[model samples]
Target: MNTVIDAHNISKVYNPTTIPVYAVNNVHLHLQKGEFTALVGPSGSGKTTLLNMIGGLDRPDEGNIFINGIDITKLSANELISFRLQNIGFVFQSFNLIPVLTAKENVEFIMQLQKASKQQREERVKTLFAQIGLQDKLNERPSRLSGGQQQRVAVARALASRPQFVLADEPTANLDTKSAFNLLDIMAKLNMEENITFLFSTHDQRVIDRARRVITLVDGRIVQDTAEVSTQHEEAAAVKT
Candidate 1:
């Protein structure tokens, strides 16, 4: 199936017993393979909330989220954890790398949890670092690398297990302009060459500009969803809103 994500009538409410506030209110979404999509809106628009639910980090109160035909919202806690490990990749704003681990080690950690063979881990890490143009920094720790380099390592880590799709929440929020553009370049290359799907929750205009599909949210609902289906030059110009 082409649909990697299918969310139906999903809703999340905070303080439902008292001052009920709907963080995500009955939203439906579907993402096909190879899509580079941006979920954007103002603060409190439920971008992160919806992303978390789709990534299996949080559950919607009212509906189901299906990832590759599996209903993640119905999975038990332990089942959900295992499912996420195998099927979902996450890139967060903080560049969440292990402090003591080297770049190679940090990327390989998830593979270790899945009990990948040493050869498999080593080869996968090598390929990912090469793809992200960070072969020299493989042995360096997160503290030794610059913010952009660290974020590249984080991207490598996210791709280690070959997740169905990647969910990145404000990945460029802490990056400088040059760094953000560099990261976007790498991600766009991956999306085009490797057909890796990415869904991002971001307020950064740099990210929004590069996305092939843009989903806008307002007050916990999807207000607009625009896609570009044209020649390369035309697609580049189309997302410039």
Candidate 2:
């Protein structure tokens, strides 16, 4: 497997001098390319903390995170931001779209920061909008779209940078059942057809049900790692046993 994320013995401690809470404790996680995985946990289970560390939004108090074989824990603050812009994509629960920009402009914003040519940005935005089935809403602002449509635009923005993987934190939390399902369908199709890797930090059953692998974290520790087994994998395991 081509491992895109390798986190080793990572820990995040909060209020270290006082209460000393362990948000994440010595967690080891590895994600391969093209895998659709869900990180499931109850609130306060440290799943979001772990995801943020992996995405370089925060650094671990101890241990290392390697994305595509580069250790991010050692990077300086500015370097970390640059690395994240190039390597990771994030979709938050709140649908953090710029209020003024249209869907097309919102998606193009990141590529512009990366210094992509105007033509490159425009072409990529069109292609992504088409892929997300939001071509018609390209000119609509977030306020003009439904919750689902806004989230789709968020997904397109996340993909605009062509990052190695997408990290979604409770992306379906704000939507109704229908909207949640629709978003999941689009994400699953993208994962299957485009070989995009997604790691979701969510408690939504809708998201969990669609994931190829489900990882359960409890009290800042991984308690279960389960993946759907294909026929070949089942047969091979039987033979080995």
Candidate 3:
């Protein structure tokens, strides 16, 4: 598999106080194309900090991040912004939808920033809303939608730009069990069907169970890395024999 993201000796430190605190300490990770990976850890374990560094939303105090073989640390601010907009999608624990905008409008917002043609934006937003089963609610604002619905809209927005990789921070944190599972199912389907890589920082067991690979972090260090055996892959291999 082609490597989609790579990190080397990444570290982040907070220097507000007399003594510096290392949020992420010399952590390294690599994610391949089409991989569904869960970055699992407790609060303050540096999962989010690591994720932010990978997404280019936050820079590491030390170390380097390479996305699609480009060293992100070497990019200027404007170049980083352009790279993130073109190649990365983000989903947050909070839906992060603008309350005033309708679902379709919210999804269209990112495409608009990318300077998509009006017709193209309309077609893409409509298709995404339909895929998320929110076609009927596309005209409704976030305030009018349920938590699950809002998150679905957020997912649609994240995919609007057709990014190769998505970085999600506690995406299922606020959902109920049913909602969380449903969201995971959608994400899993997308990961397989679209061949889009997903990297998540989550404590949710549902999210972990759905992941093809799990990386556990404790106290700013990776403690465990495991790959789940896929039954479908096994079955296909058996059939060919």
Off by over 4 Å in 2: 227-236
User: Over 4 Å off in model 3, which ranges?
Assistant: 227-241
- How far is each candidate from the true structure, as Cα RMSD in Å? 4.3, 2.1, 3.9
Q: Candidate 3 residues 170-227, lDDT tens each?
A: 9999999888887888888889888989999999888998998999999889988774
Q: What's the CA error at residue 199 for candidate 1, in Å?
A: 0.2
Candidate 3: clashing pairs of residues: none
Total clashes for model 1: 0
Cand. 2 Cα-lDDT: 0.93
Alpha carbon lDDT at 51, candidate 1: 98
User: What are the Cα lDDT values of the candidates?
Assistant: 0.93, 0.93, 0.89
Residue 200 in candidate 1, Cα distance off native in Å: 0.3
Worst 10 residues of 1 by lDDT: 227-236
Cα lDDT tens digits for candidate 1, 15-122? 999999999999989899999999999999999999999999999999999999999988999999999989989999999999899999999999998899999999
Best by TM-score: 2
